[model samples]
Target: MANTRPLVAQWSRLGNSSIAACKADIPRPALVSYQTVRHASGKPASKDKDKKKRKTRNTFRQYDLKHAMQFSLIDAMHYIRAFEVGQNPASAKYEMHIRLSTLKNGPVIRNRLRLPHPVKTDFRICVIAPPDSKAAADARAAGAALVGEDDIFEQVKNGVVDFERCICHTDSLQKLNKAGLGRFLGPKGLMPSAKTGTVVKDVGNAVKNMVGGSEYRERMGVIRMAVGQLGFTPDEMQRNITSFMDTLKKDIAQLSDRITKDIHEVVLSSTHGPGLTLNGEFKSANSIPPKELAGPL
Candidate 1:
């Protein structure tokens, strides 16, 4: 906010270095670029120096310590359906589901489902498989509670599934609804029906990982985010940068093709009128673009 140094100059500072190390020792330089810390006061004018707009630069410049400070990351893609940056919230009621599929080399998802002890916490988990044992095995790995016909009926009879702590595993589909598993779970929207991927004979491992939070999902269209604010410690921002970039990289690798088609862009920027963002126009294994979506507009 005060006397910020140019990104290139701040690149060598102990503060930035220390901050980078704290975030699993991520190299600050990799998360961002040197020029990102510095820039002309304003946009580049058509001429070398526009007398009318003296403060602005005629060309694009990178953001560094002097020009940019702080960063934030948000999964705008996962944002609820029908979201727009400046649109009215009343118009949007998001009802989107994130789907994940397994790759040959992807990690085996932990079966255990972790939830807060309170039954009303609303992080409902459904373990589905062709047979009770298969679903149980995956849920067990994730540490999810295992339920048989007995548990399902009680929940339905009581008119509530403990989203906070409830697991159902049954090979018989009829037993579930006949006992009223649907009545309670249906209203809460916790019931695992055959329509959603929840009832797959063998959920691809990626979905299990998603249930575990290690999984990544990429869908079409643009999503926005504001990386950070006007002035933040370099150390304060590296973790976000690292996590965002890592997930993005994994997503790209998972899609050998259609990376750009699915991923429109990657950007980063501050919440104000100025800052640096990766202007990667297209997606490819060679380059990862982090776009600064919103908040800065």
Candidate 2:
């Protein structure tokens, strides 16, 4: 009976030691702060810190990219003119090309701006009208390069197109096709289509205005147009560029929800110079961040 008592006591001690070891092996709850908890879980405690860091990185990238872009329209014009030191002034028109998001049959936008400083070039204009008609005489008075019916037809048929633009009386279109000028003029975008307001009864006015007008057209998701000449002053060039941007914005607004954001990038270049991207300062207020402008435009 005495031996049995000692054995029972030893067994109780063994059970107690086992319970103590089990308790020592178990983990206790950590008393960390909420922030530490969040960090441990692989999330940021405060989003602002991350955002600020991202912004700083973006600013650095923008600075790096500045060498490839101009700070403003005035700056771009200066660069373009500087690059034109030895080039012919006649071919020194400033061109702007905008990349846009992918669009399915996007709207064809055309705007005519009477630039603050008009491009001083001999803008050759051809008028397709009956030689005996008053419209033909008026076109000649408007300084049209060529004014004739069959003669103009023959010139176009012989691939002797010397005009920058073509103006036609609505009735004269049949004559143009009969001369087979479509294959020649269509490729040059000089075909007098009704959509471009080139096909009209007032051939004289059309010819005169087109001589001073710059046209913007969307081709394969890009808008390319001449903004001004290198001879224009900074203010004059800026005004012309602003007018074109305003017109473009209005046109995009009519078709989409975010007008300014729709334009992904704007690049300016002269006829003979390398392209310079415009800074984000020209972007609209709602423009997407550079990181988010990945897909289109």
Best prediction by lDDT = 2
Residue-wise lDDT of candidate 1 within 12-118, one digit each (tens)? 56456647656556565563542433334454423545666576542223224344322233222212111334544333221112123323233322122211111
Go through the candidates in order and give each one's C-alpha lDDT. Answer: 0.38, 0.69
Per-residue lDDT tens digits for candidate 2, residues 1-297, read 232344345445765884766655543333124335545688644558688777322111112333554455545555566677776665668788987664445355555555555665478988989999999999999899898889878777888999888888988888777777779999998888787778899888887787777777777667898877666555555677777788888877766553333676788888887787887353345533333322211
Task: State the weakest 10-residue window (summed lDDT) of model 2.
Answer: 55-64
Per-model TM against the reference: 0.30, 0.64
Residue 131, candidate 1: C-alpha displacement in angstroms: 11
In angstroms, the error of model 1 at 261 is 15
RMSD of 1: 24.6
